[model samples]
Target: MITLTLVGIGSGNPEHLTLQAVRALNDADLILIPEKGKAKDELAQVRREICANVLTSDVHIQGFDLPIRNEAITDYDARVNDWHDRIAVIWKQQIDAHLPDGGKVAFLVWGDPSLYDSTLRIADRIQANMPLDVKVIPGITSIQTLTAAHAIPVNTINGPFVVTTGRRLRDEGLPAGIENVIVMLDGECSFTGLNPDGLHIYWTAYAGMEGEINLSGPLSEITDEIIATRKAAREDRGWVMDIYMLVRSTP
Candidate 1:
């Protein structure tokens, strides 16, 4: 049986590894790392760093090129489904080449797998063809890291909150009947499209890493500053991973 472990490594920080994640790392027969081209080499580097720091026992580290999704396809769900199929093929090919006998293979997922991550979906695709046993190791999420960086609670006392993707927030606007929203998977700063009136925004890029950037306050007041800083950081590093929380300021 193929033992597939989807381990959450947290927000690209070596220190974010929990004791359980460390143990999972040590027990893996092979670890898969995705290389996102030259533009996002840091992602693969971070995965390697996590293995270097956490794995004392010798474990096979396998790096594979990540399949880039075609955003040109207008149908969002269709595009994602096609992408997942491609990724699963790559996963199976890598595992088969490295572990022809189907031993334990692990993937380091950013944040928790239960969140807005496609790793689980991709794994499921592979399992349809191969006999597989899957396990998820939870880790601190980007939402938690963003809130902690701002030193603010994710929601008001007894207030409702929602977690969503950047595309939804931009397309749907602030969701109905929710005071707090945590936005992720946003390549562009979608907040620029919203009406900033009475809105409080807390933004963090590289949420839990050494070079984290944070900006908060009335959206109108700090929007420009956050955008400028985010641009600079992304240019400096060749890529950036960011998340933000917004709340309609209340009396």
Candidate 2:
């Protein structure tokens, strides 16, 4: 039986690895790190650094080129599904080639697997091809890290919030009657599209890491600053993983 573990290593911070995550990495027969091309090479390098920092034992680590999503498909859902299918094929091929005898293999996921990440879905695709059992080790989410960085609470007293994506915010707008919002995977800084009345924003780039950049203020006043800071962060680091929380009339 092949046991596949998805270990969340937290948001680009090697020290964020839990003791369980460390043990899982060291115990794996093989670990696969996906290279997202030169534009996002730092992402792959961060994974390697995590392994180097933890693994007390000799563990096999391999790098694979992740397949790009087919943009020509013209449909968002179809393109993403097709891309995932292609990625599953690559993952199976890599696993079979490296650990043919059927042993434990692991993949390091950024943030908790239960969140917005698609790694769990991709793993479901792999399971259909062969006998496998999946295990997840949770790590600190950027949402948690973001709130921690600002020393602010995620929710107002007895109030609910929505955790959403940049695409959704752009397409659907904010949820009705929701006072607190945490937005992730937003390349466009989507909040600028909404009414900034009474909205206070807590924003952070590289939320959990030592080199994080944080910004906060009335959304109306700081919208331009946030956009400029975002551009600079991505330009300087070659990539940006950021999240922001919005509170309307905070307590």
Off-target runs (Cα >4 Å) in candidate 1 are none
For model 2, state the Cα shift of residue 149 in Å.
0.6
lDDT of each: 0.90, 0.89
Q: What is the lDDT of candidate 2?
A: 0.89
Give one digit per residue, the lDDT tens place, for model 2 in 14-86: 8888999999999999999998776446778889989888888878998999999888999999999999999
Worst ten-residue run, lDDT, model 1? Answer: 35-44
The TM-scores, one per candidate, come to: 0.96, 0.97
User: Between which residue pairs do clashes occur in model 1?
Assistant: none
Task: Name the 10 consecutive residues with the lowest summed lDDT in model 2.
Answer: 36-45
